[model samples]
Target: MTESLRWIKSSYSDNGGQCIEWAPEHANTHGAVPVRDSKNPQGPALLFPAPQWSHFVEYARKQSV
Candidate 1:
């Protein structure tokens, strides 16, 4: 089920190994965001509500500054 979802890494993620991927399409279609470690595609995914996910991303962006 997870394999069918398209995952995208953060643009800020380089080849440095630490990376996470999220399925935005899944969020749009299902109203929940699926996030997982990019290095572990076969691993478990953490689902978050769209609004919570948006807030998380926003907070992350602010913290990066």
Candidate 2:
């Protein structure tokens, strides 16, 4: 399922070790967001429901990191 996904990292990222990649295209069509650590492309990905992903993003955006 993940093999065909076109993963994309956040524009806000600095291309550092602490970065994640998500396939927005897939999420838009499937209603689930696929996310994985950028440093580990071959690793397992976590699939979150669209609403949950939105919440997670909102929370992360408000963090100090």
Candidate 3:
């Protein structure tokens, strides 16, 4: 795991500390979205393929931020 990956926040994350983080750069290179908790950098991460990640983002964007 490297900080070189640019982690982006979920749109659903607004004022609260609760958030989901993903590495867009990693996706560009690996074709997989590496997701983790913003509050816990060293925590476990979940990896989703591009299509699945797109669907997840679509669903997240539809929710209230």
Off by over 4 Å in 3: 63-65
Q: What's model 1's TM-score?
A: 0.94
The Cα error of candidate 2 at residue 55, in Å, is 0.7
Q: Give the candidates in order of TM-score, highest first.
A: 1, 2, 3
lDDT of 2: 0.93
Candidate 1 lDDT, 1-65, residue by residue in tens: 69999899988888688999999899999999999988889999999999999999999999999
User: RMSD per prediction, one decimal?
Assistant: 0.7, 1.4, 2.3
TM-score of each: 0.94, 0.90, 0.77
Please give, for residues 3-33, the per-residue lDDT of candidate 3 as tens digits.
6677888664684878889998888889998
Winner by TM-score: 1
- Put down candidate 2 lDDT per residue, 1-65, tens digits, no spaces: 88999999989899778999999998999999999999999999999999999999999888957
Candidate 1 lDDT (Cα, 0 to 1): 0.93
lDDT of each: 0.93, 0.93, 0.83
